[model samples]
Target chain A: MAEPLFDRLALIGIGLIGSSLAQVARREGLVREIAISTRSEKTLERARELGLGDVYTLDPAEAVADADLVVLCIPVGACEATMQTIADSLKPGAILTDVGSVKMSVIDQIAPHVPDTVHFIPGHPIAGTEHSGPDAGFPDLFQNRWCILTPDKSTSRDAIDRLTAFWRGCGSDVDTMEPGRHDLVLAITSHLPQLISYNIVGTADDLETVTKSEVIKYSAGGFRDFTRLAASDPTMWRDVCLHNKDAILEMLARFSEDLSAMQRAIRWGDAGALFDLFSRTRSIRKSIIEAGQETPAPDFGRPHKKGRD
Target chain B: MAEPLFDRLALIGIGLIGSSLAQVARREGLVREIAISTRSEKTLERARELGLGDVYTLDPAEAVADADLVVLCIPVGACEATMQTIADSLKPGAILTDVGSVKMSVIDQIAPHVPDTVHFIPGHPIAGTEHSGPDAGFPDLFQNRWCILTPDKSTSRDAIDRLTAFWRGCGSDVDTMEPGRHDLVLAITSHLPQLISYNIVGTADDLETVTKSEVIKYSAGGFRDFTRLAASDPTMWRDVCLHNKDAILEMLARFSEDLSAMQRAIRWGDAGALFDLFSRTRSIRKSIIEAGQETPAPDFGRPHKKGRD
Candidate 1:
C-alpha cells in the first residue's frame, strides 16, 4: 500500500513486545522483511509456527545481518551480551533501538557497542497487558499508546524521524525525552507501582491470621487490581528492578515515608488528613481518563453477568 | 411470585451502595416499600430524583419508623449517631443491619444502642467501582459478588435467613462470618490494598523530580490501577481507616516490612529473590480468576482501539 520504512527488520527476542512488533509491522507494511531471533529453540519454533517473521534464527548475529532496523525486545538484563553479539553484524546506517522499560540503564548497556554508522535510540512503549510470551501479543498492542524515544544529540535527526514514523505506522504517538528524565518519570509511574503491587500480593500471601482462600474469595474488593500487575512477567520485572535501582529505591522510600504518615493519621484518627489525601487523588484518575490514556468505563468495563439467584 | 422478604426496607444513606441496594431490592421485589435517609438534603433530593426509594427524608428516625428492615448505609463513623436517632423508632422484631466496611467497629458502635427486640446483623457486600454518589450506581452492582454477614450468636436464626435470602434476591452470594474474623480477613484483602493505593498515588503526586502531568500521562504503565482504588469515596475510606485501625495498622506493618525486604532485594540486585516473589504472586491472580472473583480477560477487557496511522 505504501513504501516500507526499512528493507529488513530484525527482532532480537520473540517475547510479547517482539511478537507484537512483528505482527504490527507486517500488517502495516512498515518493513519489507522481518528476522526473528531468540535463545530458546522452542520460542523460535513457535514464532515460525505462527508465521511471525520471514526468517528466524537462534543467533542474534545472523538475525542482524543485512538488517536496516534492529529492535531488542528481550529483558534489560540480557541487552549487553546480545548487543556485543550483534554489534559487528548490524548493517551500516541501520537503526538500533529497544523496547526496554528502563531507558537510562538500557542506554548505558547498549550504547557503547553501537558503531558510529548506526543510530542507537532507546525507547519504551508505555503499554502492555499482564500477559507475556509470543502468543500473548497482538497487532494492536501499541494502539493509542505512547512510544517514547530517548536519543542523544549526536544521533541523526533523520534516523529519529524515521523511527518515529515507523512507530506511528504501528499506531502509536511518539514523544522524545532525555534518558535520565525518562528513568525518573517512569520510576514513579511504572517501577514503583509494580514493586508496590508485588509487595502487597506477597504480604497477603504470607498472612497467618487470614486464610489464602479468604483472600482469593474477597479479592474483588481491591487486591485483585494489584494482582493483575503482580501477574506480569517476573523476569522482566526483576530486570527492571535491577536496572532502575536508584530511581526505584528513591520512589519506594518516598512511598514508605508517605505511608508512615498515613499510618499515623489512621492510628491517631486524623480523619481530616485522610480525607484530604483521598480527595486529592480522585482528581488524578479524572485527569488520566480525560487524557485518553485510560478507559472511561467503570471497573475498566469488565463484564458483569447478572448475579446468581 | 415469591413473597417480599420485608414489608419495608429503610436505607439510612443513598450513596453508591445504598442506591444500588434500593434499585436491586425493588427490581427483585424483595421489599414492599423503601424509605431512604441522608444527612445531606442534596443527597436525599438526588435519591428522590433517581427514584431510589419510595419515600425520602433527611431524618434517620423518620426513615426507620415502621420499617421491618433498617439498614445503616452511612459511613461507619456516623453509624453511632444514626443508630442513636433511629433506635427508639425501630419496629419490634425488625432486623437492623449495616453495610459498613469495618465489621467489628460497626458492631461496637451500634450494638449498645439496639433494643433486645431488634436483630443486629452487620454486612459488607464485596463489590464497588471507582465511583460514588447516588447517580453512580446500577442495579447490577452486587451481581455475582459476595455479601459477607457478620452476626453474633444472639442474632435470631430467622432474621439471618431472611437477610441472606434478600441479598441473594439482590444477586449476591451470602457468607456468614464473625465480626472480628471479617475485620481481619478484609484488612488484608481490602483495607491494606486501598491504603497502599492511596499512599502510592500520593507519593507520585508529591514527587519533585516528576511532574504531575507526566505521572498522569504515563499512568497506564502501572500507576493507573492504584488510582482507581485511590479514587474511592474520601469520607467512606477515612471512616474505614479510623474504624478499622488495629487490623489495618497490623496489615500495614506487614506490607511495609515486606516492602522493605523487597527494597533490600532490589538494592542488592537479588534477581533470584525478585523472580521468586514475582512468580509466586502470578498464581494468586490465576486463583482469583478461577474463583470467579475476577474477570479472565486481559487488562480487565479494557477496549484497545486500532492505532492511529
Candidate 2:
C-alpha cells in the first residue's frame, strides 16, 4: 500500500492516542513497522499482549533507535523528559511529531532536543473518547477527525508532506497552522471546555444542598453531558492545563465575565438579555452539525428503549 | 388492555414535551382522546399535520373544556396567563398539571388561578434532546427516563397515583418530591449545566482570536458537547432561567467559585490539585452511567466510519 510511508514508526507512549495510532497505522499500512514504548512496564506488556506493534520496549531511546518516524504519544508534561531521553537516539533523517492537545508548549519542550537533520512537527488530532489506555483505542479513532500539524518555517516541506500523508492514511484530514495560533485556538475549543466540565462536575460533587445521589439520578437533564468530558484521562488533561496556561486562563476569564453578566441578567429578570444569548448560541451548534463535526441525532443518539406500541 | 387512565387528555402546548406526551399517551392507550392547544397557529397546524392529537385548537379554554386531565405544557413564563384563560373551562375533578422545568415558580404562578375542584400537580419529565417543536418528538422520548412529579400535600393521593400511572405507561420511571426541593435539585442537575453550556458557546462565538469557521471545524475535541445543551429551545430555557432564578443563581455562584479556584490552581501550575480534581470527577460519570442515567458508549456512541481492516 503505497510503499508504506515510513520504514519504522516509534510511539513513545501506549495510552489511548498511542495505541490508536499504532492500530490505525498498521491497519492502513501507513508504516512498515510499529515500535511501542511506555514508562510503565505493565503498559508495555499490555501493548505486547494486544499485539499492537512489531516491537515493544520500556526504553524510549531503545524504541526510537533506527526508527524513521518517532511520535511522542505521552502526556504533554512528559514530553520534555521523553525528548531528552530519546534525542540522541533519533535517526538523523527521522520525522518527529506528537499528538498533544496544546501545541506551543509541546514545541517548546521538544524542539531544543530535536537534531538538526531530524524534522520536528507538532500535531494534535481533535479526536478521542472519554476512555483511555491501550484497550480503549480502536483503529477508527482518527476516522473523519482533524489532525492539525504545526511545523516551524525551517522544517522541510517534504517532511511535513510525508507526515500529512501518514495522518491521511490513518483516516484523518490534515491542516497546518502556526503553533502559537494552534495553542490559542485549541485553548478555547478544547482546553476551556474541558476545564469548565471538570469544574462543574466538581461543584456538583461538593454541593450540600443537593445530594450526589440526586445529581446522578437527574443528570439526564444536562449534567451528564459535562461528565463525559470530565471523565477524560486525568494525566492528559492536567498536562493540558499546566502547559496551555496563558490561553486557557484568558478563555476562563472571558467565560467567567460572561457568566457573571448572565447571573446579573438572571437576577434582574432580564428575559431579553438571556433570550438573546441563548438564541445566538443555537446557530453555532447548527454550524457545527452542518460542518460534519457532530452527529445530528437527538441526545447524541443515546439508545432509547423501544416503546411497546 | 386496561382501561385508559383519562377520558380526555388536554395538552395546552404543542412543543417538545407536549408533542411527546401526545404521541406516547396515544401509543400506550393512556388516554382515550387527546386535545392539543398552542398560541401559535403555525405550531398548531404543524401538530395537526403530524396528527399529534385527536383535537387541535389555538384556544386553550376550548381545548381544556370537559377534559379529565389538563396539562399545561407551555413554557413556564406562559403558565400564569394560560392557567387564567383555561381555569373556568376545566372539568371538575380533573387532574390539572404541568411539565415545566421550574416547579416552584410554576406552582407560584398557577396555584392562585387553579380551581379548588381540580387537582394541580407539577411534573418535569427529565428527558429531552437538543431538538424542539412538535415535529421533533417521538413516542419513545420518555422511555427509560425519569419523570418527576411535585404535588402539594393537599393534592389527593388518588389523583397523584393516576398521574403516576400515566407516566409509567409512557415508559418513564416516576418519582415524587416537594416542589421547592425539586427546584433546588434541578438547579444543580439541569439548570446550571445548561447555563454553563450556553455561556461557553457564547464565549467561543464571541472570540475574535478564533474564527467561527475554525471553532466549528475543530469542535469534536470537547466544544461540541456543550453545543448540544446550548442548542436547546431558547424560549424554554429563557423561561427556565427567569422562573428558577434563585436556585440557578445559587448554583451559578457555586460553580463560578469552584472555577476560580481551578483557575488559580492552573495559573500557579498546581499539577497535584489539577490531577486530584480530574481524577475525582471520573467516578461521578461512572456513577451516572451505572445509575442508568447515561449511556456507557464511547463518545455517546456517535457513529464512526469503519476501518478497512
Candidate 3:
C-alpha cells in the first residue's frame, strides 16, 4: 500500500524474534522479498513450510545476496562467525543490522568483519516471550514495543534513517542510543533480571526439602512468575551473560548486597525497614503501568478468561 | 442448596486472601454468619463498606465468641498477638485455624497461646496475586487452586474432616501435609521466587547506567513478570521472609551456587549446556499445564479479550 519499505530484506535467524519480525513485516508490507537463513537445516525447512520468506537457505551469504537490508537474528556468540561468512556476499550499499540483546559486544565482534561499503547498525527489539523457535512467534510481537539502535559515529546517516524507517514499518517505535549505554541499560532491564530468574529456579530445582511435585503444584502463589523468565531460550541468554559480563556482574553485586541487608533486617525482625523498602518499590510498578509498559493482572502465569482490562 | 457449613465464622484479617475468602464464602452461602476483625480501624471500615461480613469488630476476642470457626488471617508476625487476644473467647470444640504462608512459625507462635478446648488446624492457601487490601480481592480467587492444611498430631480427626469440608465449600482442593514439610515446600515454591524478584527489581532501581525510565518502558519483554511478584504487599512479604528465614537462606545459597555455574558456562560459550537446560524446562511447563496448574495466555498480564488462547 505504501510502496513496500525495502525491495528485498534478509533475516539470518528464524527463531521467535526473527519469525515474529517476518510475520509483522509481511503483514505491513515492509519488504517485497524476504530471504530467511539459519544454520540448522531443519529450521530452514520449517521456515520454507511456513512460507515465511520468498527465499530460504542454509547459506548466510546466499540469503543476503541482492538484499537491500540484512538483519542478524542469531545468538550473540554466533554473530562474528556469521558476519565473516556473509561479508563478501552482502550488497555493497545494503544496510546490515542485528537484533542482539547486548549491543557493545556485537559492535566489537561484527563491525570489523563488515565491508566499509555496507551499513552496520546494531539494534535490539525489546520484545519476546519464553517460547522460542518459529512457531512461538506471532505477528504483533513488535507492536507498541521499543526498538533500540546503536549506530557508530562513522555510520552513514542514510543507513540509520532507512533502518529506523524499517523498524517503524515493522510496528516498532525506534530510538537511537550509544553502544555502551545500550548495553548497560539492557543489562539491568533484561540481562540481570534473566540471570536472577534462572538462578532462583535452579535453586528451587535442587532443594531436597521441597519435592518437585509440590513446587509445581503450588507455583501459582508466587514462584510461577519466575518460571516464565527462567523458561527463556538459554542459549541466547547464556550468550547475553557472557557478552555483557561487566554490567551484569555489577548489577548482580548490587543485588546481592541489597539482599543481604534485607536478610539482616528480616533476621532482626525489623518490620519497619523491610516494609519501607517494599513499599517504595510499589511506585515503580505504578510507574510502569502508568507508562503503558505493563498490563495489570489479578494473577500471575494464569490467563483471565472472564475479565477484560 | 446444601445447608450452610457453619453457624458463625470469624475472620481475623481483611487483606487480599481474607477478603477474597469472605467474598467467595458469602457468594457460595458457606456460612450463616460472618464476623470480621482487624487491628486497623480504616481497613475494618472498608470491609464493612464492601459488606464482606455480617458482623465487624476491632477486637478479636469479641469476634470469635460463640463462632463455630475462627480463622486467623493476619500477617505471620501478628499471629501470636491475635492468638493471645482470642484464646479465652473461643467456643469449646470450635475449629481454629490460620492462613499463614509459613506453617511452622505460625504453629509455634499461635499454638502456645490457644486453649486446649479449640481444635487448631493451620493452613496455607496456594493462591493469591501481588495485590493486597480488602478492595484488591475477588469472589473466585480460590477456585481451582490448592489449599494445604498442616494439622498437628494432637488434632482431632473430626476437626480435620470438618476443615477439609469447609475449604471444599470455598471451592479449594484441600491437601494434608506436616507443618515442617509445608514450610520447606513453600520456601522453594513461594519464598525464594519472591526474594529473587525483589532483589532483581532492587538491582534495576540502583543501576547508574540504566535509567529507570528505560527499565520501565522495556519491561514488557521479560522484566514485567518479576514486577508482579515484587509488587506484593510489603508487610505480608516481610513477615514471610522473617518467619521463613532458615529455609529461604538455604535456598538463596543454592541459587547463588547455580548462578556461578551458569556464569561459567556462559563464559565458556557452551551452547550445548544452555540448550540442554532450556529444553528440559519446557517439559516442566508442559507438565504444569497437563496437571491443570497453569493457563496458557496470549499475554502474561493481560486479560484475554480475544477468543483465541
Candidate 4:
C-alpha cells in the first residue's frame, strides 16, 4: 500500500458518515492513526466496539489534539458548537473539514471559530443509505460516489489539493463549487426531495380514508420508493432544513407551483399535459443511468424473496 | 402439479404485466395453453419472438374466443375500446379480468360489455419496475407481491375464488377491496407520489441556477430516488391520470395542503415540526419491510463498482 496520507485523522461524530470514513481510511491505509469522538456516550462506545478507530474519546477537543486532519461529521446545526469546542485544540497546521449537506451554513457557522493557522475546507458527500448510526456504514460507501468540496478564498491551494487527493484516495470523484451554489443545487437534489418525501409519508400516515396497514401493504406501487428517502436520519434532515432554509423554501415553492399545474391537469383530465411532463421526466433517469450515476435495475434491483417461487 | 388451473388462458396486451404472466403461467403450469394479443403489431411480434405464449395474435377477439380465462393486460384507457371488440366473442362462463392501476375506472369501462354468463374481475398488482414492454419482464415480477382483486357484486363466488387461486399460483397474496376505496388508497400510496416525483424532476430540469450536469452528478443524495418512479411507463401513467381523475385530484389536493404546511414550517425554522415529521416517516418503511412488502436493503442493495474499495 501507499504511505499513509496523514499521521493522525480525527472524526468528531461517529455516525454513518464518520464510521464509513474510518472504515475506508483503515481499508485503504490512508491514515496511520484514527481518532473517533462523539457527543453521545453510546455512539462512542459503539465506535469503540466496532474498532472504527485506534483511539476513542468523548471530548471533541481531545480527539482533535495534534491530529493532522479533523472532520466534523455531525448534524449541520451542531457545526458551530463543535467548532467552538475544538477551536483551541485543533492542530496548528491541521486541515479542518465537515461532511454537512448545507455548505453555506456550515461555512457561516464554523468559519469564525477556525483558527487562522488551520485550514478549513467544507465538504458534502453525495452518498448514504436511509439507515444511520455507526453500524450502518461500510468501507465502500464512498466508492464511485461524488464528494463535493467547497473552499473559501483564504484556503490554501496546497491544502485544497491535499484534501482532494484524500477524498480521491477514499474512492470518491471530487468536485469544487461555490458554497452558496452548492447549497442551492443540493436544495433541489437532496433537501427538496427529502422534504417532499417526508411530507408525502406524513400525509399518507394521517389519512382517515386509508388505513396505515393498507398504505404499508401496497407501498410497492410507488409510495415505497419515497419512504426510503423519508426514512433518512431525522436529525440530519432537520438540520438540513433549518440550515438551508432559503434554498429549500425556493425549491419547494417552485415544486408546489408545478404540482398545482399537475393537479389541475388531473382535475381537468388533460392527457396531453400529463403525458408531456411524464414523458420528459422519463429521459432524465435514462441520462442518470447512462452517466453511471444510478443503477439500471428495476425497483433498485431488490432481490426476490427466497422459497416463494 | 395441481392439474393446471385452466385448460386455456388468453392474455391481451403483451407488455410487462402480460409477458410476466405468460412466463409465470408456463413456469408454474397454471394453465395448459397460453394465448397472447396486443394492439401494437410490433409488441405482438416481440412477444412472439420471446415465445411469451404458445399462441400470439393481433386480434383480441380471436385470442379470447375459446379461452376459459382471459386477462386484459392493456392500459385502462384502451379497456373500453378493446371490450367493445371482444364482448361478443368472449366465451360464455369465461372469467375475464384486468390488471390496471385504477380499479373503479377499469370496472366502469368493462362492466358494461361483460355478458351475464361471464365473470369480470379488475385487479391491480402492486408490483412493477420502471421498465416496460414485452422484453422487460420476468416470471418473478409478482413474487411475494400483493394482487388486489376488486370484483363486481354480481360476480359469482366460484369465479372470485378461482381467480384468487390463479393469482396465488402467480405467487401473489391476494386481497379484496371496494373499487372506490381501492382508488382512494392507491391515490395516496401510488398516484400522488408518482405525480410529485414527476413534478420534482421537472422542477430540477427547468432550473436556471443549477446545471443539469450537477443535478445528475449529485442525484444519489435523494433526487434519484424519485427518478425511478418518475421514469415509469409514461403512457400507462398518463392513462392512469385520466382514468382515476377524481381520486387522484383529491389525493393531490390533500398532499398539496400537507406540503404547504411543511413549507410553512421550513420557512419559520420549526425544527421540532420538521424533526417529528421526518422521524415519524422512518417507521413506515420498517413496517413495509416487516410486512414482507419491500426489500430491507439500503438503497435497494445497489452493488458497488468492481475492484474499487
Instruction: Please name the candidate that would achieve the greatest DockQ relative to the true structure.
Output: 4
On residues A150-235, what C-alpha lDDT tens digit does candidate 1 reach at each position? 99998899999999999999888899999999999999999999989999999999998899999999998889999999999999
> How big is the positional error of residue B214 in model 2, measured in Å on the Cα after superposition?
1.5
Error of 2 at B169 (Å): 0.6
Q: Per-residue alpha-carbon lDDT of model 4 for B208-299, expressed as tens digits?
A: 98999989989988898889989988899999999888888888888889988898998999989988989889899999989887778877
Instruction: Write the candidate numbers in order of decreasing DockQ.
Output: 4, 1, 2, 3
Lowest lDDT 10-residue stretch of candidate 2 chain A: A300-309
Local distance difference test, candidate 2: 0.91
Please, what are the lDDT tens digits per residue for candidate 2 over residues B196-217? 9999999999999899999988
Against the true structure, what is each candidate's TM-score?
0.97, 0.98, 0.94, 0.98
- The collision pairs in model 3 are none
RMSD from true fold, candidate 2: 1.8
Worst lDDT run of 10 residues, candidate 4 chain A, spans A300-309
| Tens-digit lDDT string for candidate 4 (A134-182) | 9998988888889999997878999999899889988899999999999
List native contact recovery per candidate, as a fraction of 1: 0.87, 0.85, 0.55, 0.81
> On a 0 to 100 scale, what is the lDDT of residue A207 in model 3?
68
User: Which lDDT values do the candidates have, in the order given?
Assistant: 0.91, 0.91, 0.82, 0.90
| Candidate 3 per-residue lDDT over residues B1-309, each given as its tens digit | 678888999999989888988988888888889999998999999999999999999998999997999888889989998888888999998999989899999999988877878899999888888888999888777777789999978889999998898888777889999888888788888887887777778767877767888889878767777887888888888899888888877777777777767666666666677566655565555556566667655445353222221
Q: What order do you get sorting by TM-score, best first?
A: 4, 2, 1, 3
DockQ of 4: 0.75
The alpha-carbon lDDT assigned to residue B105 of candidate 1 equals: 87
Error of 1 at A195 (Å): 0.3
